[model samples]
Target chain A: MKTLSSTWKEMKKYRHSYLMIAPYYLPFLVFTVFSVLMAMGLSFSYFNVLETPRLIGWQNYINLFLQDDIFSIAMKNTFLFVAITGPASFILCFFVAWVINEMRPKVRAAITLVFYAPTLAGVSAFAIWKFVFSGSEYGLVNAFLLKAGLLMEPLTYLKDIRFILPILIVVQLWMSLGHSFLAFIAGLQTVDRKLYEAAAVDGVRNRWQELWYITLPVMRPFLLFGAVMQIAQSFGVSAVSINLLGFPTTKYAGRTIVTHLMDYGIIRYEMGYASAIATILFLMQVIFNKTVQRGLKRIGE
Target chain B: MTNRLNRSVGGTLFLLFFLGFLGIFMVIPLVFTISNAFKPLNEFYLFPPKLFVRNPTLTNFTDLKQILANFWIPFTRYLFNSLWVVVLGTGGHVLFVSLAAYPMAKHDFPGKNLLFSITVLALMFSPEVTKIPNFIIMSKLGLIDTYTSMIIPSLVFPLGLFLMKQYMEDLPDSLIESAKCEGASEYAILFRIIIPLVKPALMTIVLFNFTFVWSQTSGEMGGGYIFSEKLKTLPYVLVQITQGGFGSMQVFAWDGIVAVINFLLISIPIAVFLITQSSIVETMATSGIKD
Candidate 1:
């Protein structure tokens, strides 16, 4: 606390610089960073919608890990989502960008738009998936498979835990191609064509060799950027769960830490439990980011 | 000649395969969304689903017009509310981000690295994780259920700041140095010299922010922020209409109209993307992923 005061005094000397940055950092502190800290604080206290929060240190965290079965299930499901979607989508984005990077400018634009359509449609627009996989025979999946004689009966894709997570993964991947894909496209364009020319002279006889040795090294930054966005987007899988799988989802198959947070925060009004969920989710994100960043260092090697 | 033909055949086949996969997963669903907007009511519940409309009709849109006519606050008000909010939010975000980004990108100020680091670290956690605490903060500041609540939080998008900073770093330091030698204040350097040079980056911010805020109006996400009907946004109203939560008519029975409404809601951002395609894609390419 004493060091904070000293830093404040020192900050006064460069107040203008601080002031210039304040419009962003100040609101960011108040809205984003402060709220995050407040969430950490609130995790230690009990508060329903009606009452003032009461101090109940460690109870929420204790119950979250030990007593709450659903939280564990949510964690497991969330890990499954992140594990499956993050790497799969990142790899997919890179390769697609590589392929598209070879096309003429007009062709590249059209293909990029085709791939980027869903992302532009936004999360809400993904509600189309609900109708596409709707339980009724009128649903797109049921109609096609049945017409093709693949199934005698239409399965309830969203309601069935067996199919929900898998279907959710598909829709998640579809929307996941947005920010990272464009970044890779742009990054690929930024990579010098002369490098490939030089690599060929250096005995890089194959496209794979060229990609591994030149393209990958040059686009490492884009890969890392795409990975971070992928990780965050995949881990933060609430809206898809809620819209596609239904709230509290059947057998808790679609439940993730985020949906659980929403369960407590919005539905049950258990602010403390919800904040605890938020904190744990935040901690998970921080850990994943740190681990991936450390792993990126080895990419150049 | 045969060898060249063989290689070209293989490449064409690969392209076909890629397009086939994308067509099934990406293209068809989008085609469904657009075509289904014109679908007839009976076509919606048909035993076998159809992708293209059998008979195109304007009934769904006319129904929408009727519904819009009956809204207590009138439909144009919601439209204006959403437009102004997006304009203000996106406008403010582009300005503030670029202002901060100039110093962070160009200057050798104390704690600059730390400031840049905080924003980068903040990126890993989207607003969803902190929505509850943000709600609490908004309520404490009496901003909940107000336009300020939405606008203020959005004015400092972390991604936008990082994007601008990365772009501004590409600007030559000599540009700012010469201006400084002439006794121009940091503010003048930023407004007069820095901004004009970084117009493309600024356009990128505007396009991205517009799409983001435009899409956010879908009531499921942050619909809880504004309670008053007049303050509500277009997408929020679209959600309400789709769920049959608004309007007294038996509109839910008409899935075609609801689908049309959903299509209409999503089209705005798509238009914005097409308009600013170059900057958005180019800016994203320049977006470096690591420290």
Candidate 2:
């Protein structure tokens, strides 16, 4: 009885600890771990979501890497988007954050909001921007270009394949300004003011030099994090691209991995194939994240 | 000395010119959108894009009214859905995360280090990887398209968990020990003692979740809207409008602009949330860093 009572006492001590963490941990284990295990298992089979999934055994993956033309295009577009948006957003965001950080405190906060505001704007703002960039004669972009004598006629920005991806890239940079800018701002705030002051005393007078030796080296972790996030975000560019600009753009330029997944999963009812694509996307992100983590570790050292 | 002074002046002028160029590039879209919101349809189509809304009318507002009428069914319901989901969802997140965070940050449990490491590792997984499995689970539970589907899945935010854990790690440990010596229950200790101390972290989580939840509805419009046309959120309605493809041009009306404006109106809560919480947001960004 004494032993049991002592055990109960011990258990009671840990009860609150268990309760505190369980809400997030349990759901995470189930949804993140269990569901992922199930998805991995399901990827081997032809699951229509309703019907019992039959074991197809690697055929879905086989087809994804081999037979699918749309899959190739989707993969290509996703890579292209990552290539374009990742660096463009990162450099632009880092520069803006640096500039904002250079300002006085009140002015800095206000301008940070200005730069970050577009990111908070999200799709609603994107839609408004879409109107401004519309192909019509009255569309602000076209109207301005026409007035400047750059072009005699309004260009079909969304419809034309040559311009669609770049347009998407630009829109993405603007909308995502907040997250990366905040990340950069977060990074910038951590730079040792003493280091900069010492550098200034040693004749490091320009913004460029101070940023190079003091700022960049100090903010390396944040820079790595922001870069990784941008890369991951750019990789998933299909969500906005598909929604804003339809798939099979005049040249199939904007059809991304996600678009292909939606096409198969929702439009075509090929859940098995879609699951395979999702699996590949998961693998790619994991690799990218690990690489960034390694990079961050090196920078930390 | 005069030549050096001239060079400095020239350089300053060049720098100002460049800054102005970039500023204009950044500001034009913003100015145009706000201006166009108040402009008449005639002004919208004008070449050189009228810099001012000459003869600004409430026509846009009237059009907004018509669109709101058409969209009224879905818009309000969606707003309510998002509000509850974000509120309850973010609340649950903050509560659970802080609870978990305090233990990991402060206490030396049997497996604390292992648990902390794993939690940190979990932060690396992208939401896309987890989303499908989450959707499947939601479907299995018959929670698809319901508020439960949206809110329940988000309660376990890895990033929030990580951030909270990181924030709490810096907290002084004596606070917990003092409360313990008072013979306070652990629940009392956590709820009464630890939570209030982490107001900044809590506010950051709240503000982050509020903005994220609002924007997520915009991005994942189809998932939340489900089959109920009346249940469609503001962004979902805009998506539907856009996705309907311009093929439905016959139905195009002035009301479309109003509908868009009404969509913009829904952003006010988000804006206010950001403005009020801006300081907290700034702190979260800058607090531990070199600044």
- Number of the top lDDT candidate: 1
List TM-scores for all candidates, in order: 0.94, 0.86
**Candidate 1 to truth, TM:** 0.94
Question: In model 1, which residue pairs have backbone atoms overlapping below 3 Å?
Answer: A186-B285
lDDT score of residue A21 within candidate 2: 81
Sliding window of 10 residues with minimal summed lDDT for model 1 chain B: B1-10
True contacts kept of each: 0.57, 0.37
Per-model CA lDDT versus the true structure: 0.81, 0.66
* Model 1 per-residue lDDT tens digits across residues A140-227: 8998889899989988988997898888889888877878898899999898877887777788866667778888988888887787
Q: What is the lDDT of residue A93 in candidate 2?
A: 82
Worst 10 residues of 2 chain B by lDDT: B1-10
In candidate 1, what are the lDDT values of residues B1-291, reduced to their tens digit? 111111255665686688668657777788888888888788887768877889988788888888788667788888888888888899889878977898788876678998888888888875677889887878888987788876876696788998899888888889889998999998999999999887777878887787777766665555557877778888877877777777444446267667788789778777877778888776876688665
| Residue-level lDDT tens digits of model 2 in B131-160 | 556667777878776766667656776667
Cα distance off (Å), candidate 1, residue B209: 1.7
> Which residue pairs show backbone clashes in model 2?
A189-B291, A190-B289, A190-B290, B64-B258
- Docking quality of model 2: it rates as acceptable
